[model samples]
Target: MTHALVDSQSLPAELRPYLDGLVRRTLAVCGRHLVSVFAVGSIALQDYRHGRSDVDVTVVADPLIPARALRELAESLAHPALPCPAAGLELVVYGADFVGRPCGAAGYLMDLNTGPMLPNRVSFDPADSADFWYVIDRSIAHQAGRLLYGTAVRQVLAASSERDLYAAMQASVREHAGGEGHLGDNRVLNGCRTVAFCRTGRWLAKREAAQMIATSEQEFRPLIETALHSFQHPRSEALPLPSNDVRTFLAWVGERVDEAATHAGIGDPGSGTYPDG
Candidate 1:
C-alpha cells in the first residue's frame, strides 16, 4: 500500500517515516472495511513537532464493522512490536455517513490515544464520541489533510455552515476549559486555537494558533508564548511553567466564546470537548 500522502519535507526529518509506516499499517489492518483514512490535525498541516505532536488520524468506515475486529485492529496497531512515534496515535474511527451531520451520527468505533511505542500503552474509547473535530476536521482534511487511502475528504464531508463551525469551536473551549485542569502545554495551544477558529474560519494547528493569538490578539500573548515554548522545547533547561497566565488566558477565552456564540446567534454550546485531534 502507498504511504506517502503529503510532502515529506514539511514535517520533522525524524518523524516522517514513522507516520508513513503508521498510514501503511492502518490501511492494511482496516482492509475492505476502511472507506478511507485521512491524516488530520497538526501533522496534516505540516506543523507537527517531533517530540510534542500526535499522529492525528481519522478512519472513515462505510459499513458497521464488528467491535471485536476493530479492537483486534487496535491491539495490533498498539502492540509493543509496532510502536507509535509521536506522543501517541490519536485516531478517530467513525462511519462515513456521519461526515457532516451535526446532530450526531453513529457513535465512533474507536477513539484511540495509543501512547508512544516504547511502552506501548493505549487509551481506547468507543463511546458516543462526537465533538469539535467533526466540522473542523472535515474542513482540514478536505483542504490540507493527506489522504492515506479511499475517497477524498471533500466527497466524504458535506458543506459546513458558519454556525456549525462556531458550535464546534465553542464546544472545544467550553468542555476542555473547565476541569480544574491546569494550563499545560496542550491546554494552552488548544485554547488559543479554539478562540482563533471562532474568530476566523481558518483552522490552524496549535503552534500557528498560538501565533494568531500572540501577534494579533494582545491579551493571550504571554500565555501563548509560554505554551509555544513548552510545546517546542518541553525539555528545555530551566523553563518555568506559566501557571497563572494559563489559567487567566483560559478564562479569557471562555468569555470570548460567549461573545462568539452571541455574535453567531447560536446558544451556549454543550459538546465542548477538548480538541484532541
Candidate 2:
C-alpha cells in the first residue's frame, strides 16, 4: 500500500527533499494505517523562513494503529534520524475519526515536537494540556493546509467555529500576557495574527498580519517592525524585546478580540478551560 505525495511543486526548492523524506518515512512506519498528511503553518502559507520556521505537519492515521507503531514512527522522525531543513518539525498524528471533529472533541494520538529551537517532546496522551495551541493550529490547517500526501485536506479536516477560534485567541493572548513563553518576536507577531483573524475571519501569516496591523496601528509600528526584523534575520544579534510594551500590545489585541466576540454574541470568554502550551 503506497501513496503518492503531491503539492510539492509549489513549495520552496530546499524544502522538497525534506518533505519527501517525511512522507516516505511516515509511509514506511505507519504502512497501511496512514490516511493523510498535511503541511500547515509557515510551509503551507508560503511564509517559511529557512532558519526560523518549523515544519508543521499533521498526519491522520487509522484509529486502529498500534501504540508500538506510533512509537516507532516518532523515533524515526526525531531530529537526528531524519535531518530537518527548518528549525525543527512539529508533527501531530490524529486518529482518522478525530480529523473533521470540533476542537475540544478532537484529541491527537501523538504530538511530537522536535527541532533545534524547540525542546524535544513526544506525547501520546489525547488529554494533553496543550489543546489551546493544538485547537488553533487545527483551525489554521482547515484554512491553509496543503495536502502533501493521501486524501485532500477539505475531505479530512473541518473548519473551526468562530467561537472556538475566538476562545483560542483569547487563551493565547492570556498566556503571553502571563509570560509563559519566550521568543518576543513570535509573541508580538502572534498578537497581530490573532487580532487580524478576529476582525477578518481569516488567518494571515504572522508577518503578513503584523505588516497589516502596522499600517493602521501607528503606535505599535516600531514594535511590529522590531518583530519583523528579528523574524527575518533569525541568526543576527538582536536586542531583547521590551517586555512591558509587548504585554501592552497583547492586552490591546485581546481587548479587540473580546469586543468583536461580544458584538458577534460568541458567549463567555472564560466558558472553557483551555490550558496554554
Candidate 3:
C-alpha cells in the first residue's frame, strides 16, 4: 500500500493515536484500493476541541472497490471497534473517479457516523439528500484539509465553484433557521462562519469567524460571545441559547450571502448542480 508523508508534528497530540489506528484499520480493509485519507472541518482549521468537535474525514478509494470491502470498512471503523477519542467520527468515502471529475453534487460510496452521543449510521447511497453540507465540505477539504494518508488533497479533489458554495451557504442558513440540522451553539457558530465566508471567500474556524464578526457588528457581540463560550465549554451547564435571536441572526446572514452573491454576479442560489469550473 502506497502512503503519503504526513507531518505528524503539526497535528494535535491527542489525535495521533486515533488517527494512526484509523489509517491502519483502513489499510487493512481497503488495501490497494485506498487512495487518500484527509481531515477537514475544525481539525484542519486548527480549532479542534477534544469534547466539542468531531473528526471529519474524507477517504478516497479506487473506483472499483467492491461492496463487501465497503461494509467491512464501516464495521471496522465504528466506535468500540476502533474507539474514537473525540466526540465522534464523521467519515465519508468517495471513489477516486468521483473526486477526479468536475460534476457537482456529493457522490459518495459510504458515509459513517460513529462515536459517543452520535448515531450509529452507515449509509452507502451516492446520492444522499444532504448535498449542501458535503459540497461545502469538499470545498473546505480542497482549501484546507490536512492529509493523513494519501496523495495531496488539491491534486485529487476538484475545486467547488463560488456559485455552489453560495448555494450551499443559503441551504445551510435555511436549515438552521428552520431548526432542521444543527442546533444550539453550533447553529450560532455556523451562522457566524457563513457571514465571514460571504465577506471573504475563505473558511475560518467558528471561533475566529465569530470574534471577527463581533468586532465590527458590535450589536451581536453578546450573542457571538455566548456561542463561543458555550462551544468551548461543552460540558458546562450553560443556559439555553436564545432561539429567537439565533433565528434572526441566521436570517440576516442569509441576506448578506444573497447580497454578496448578487454583487459577484453569481445570480440566485439554486438547488441544482452547476459547472465545477
- Model 3, 1-277: lDDT tens digits are 3323376667788888888789888988999999999999998899999887899999999989999999999999999889898889999999998988654577899999999858889999966557788888898898899999878998899988878788888888777777654657888888899899888889999999999999988877898899888887753344467888887777777788888888989977754322111
Of 1 and 3, the candidate ahead on TM-score is 3
TM-scores for all predictions = 0.80, 0.93, 0.93
Candidate 2 lDDT by residue in tens digits, 1-277 = 3335696678878788888889999999999999999898998778998888889999999999999999999999998788887888999999888877776433889999997767788999967655678878898888999889998888888777777777777878888776665578888899999888877888899999999999999999999999898887764344468888888888788788778888889865545332222
Quote the positional error of residue 39 for candidate 2 in Å.
0.5
1 or 2, greater by lDDT: 2
Worst 10 residues of 1 by lDDT: 117-126
C-alpha displacement of 32 in model 1, angstroms?
A: 1.9
Q: Write the per-residue lDDT of candidate 1 for residues 1-277, one digit (tens) a residue.
A: 5445445555566766776776667666777777777788886787876666667788887656777667766776673445666666777777777764543222466766676533343334534444566567666766677776678877775656666666666665655555353337777788887778778866777788888889987866776787777777633332455656665767777777767777877766543433222
Candidate 2 worst ten-residue window by lDDT? 268-277
- Cα lDDT of candidate 2 equals 0.83
Q: Considering lDDT, where higher is better, how would the candidates rank from best to worst?
A: 3, 2, 1
Clashing pairs in 2: none
After superposition, the stretches of candidate 2 with alpha carbons farther than 4 Å from their true spots are 1-4, 235-238, 271-277
Instruction: Please list the C-alpha lDDT of all candidates, in the order they appear.
Output: 0.66, 0.83, 0.84
User: What would the TM-score be for candidate 2 when compared with the true structure?
Assistant: 0.93
Give the residue spans of candidate 3 off by over 4 A: 1-5, 235-239, 271-277
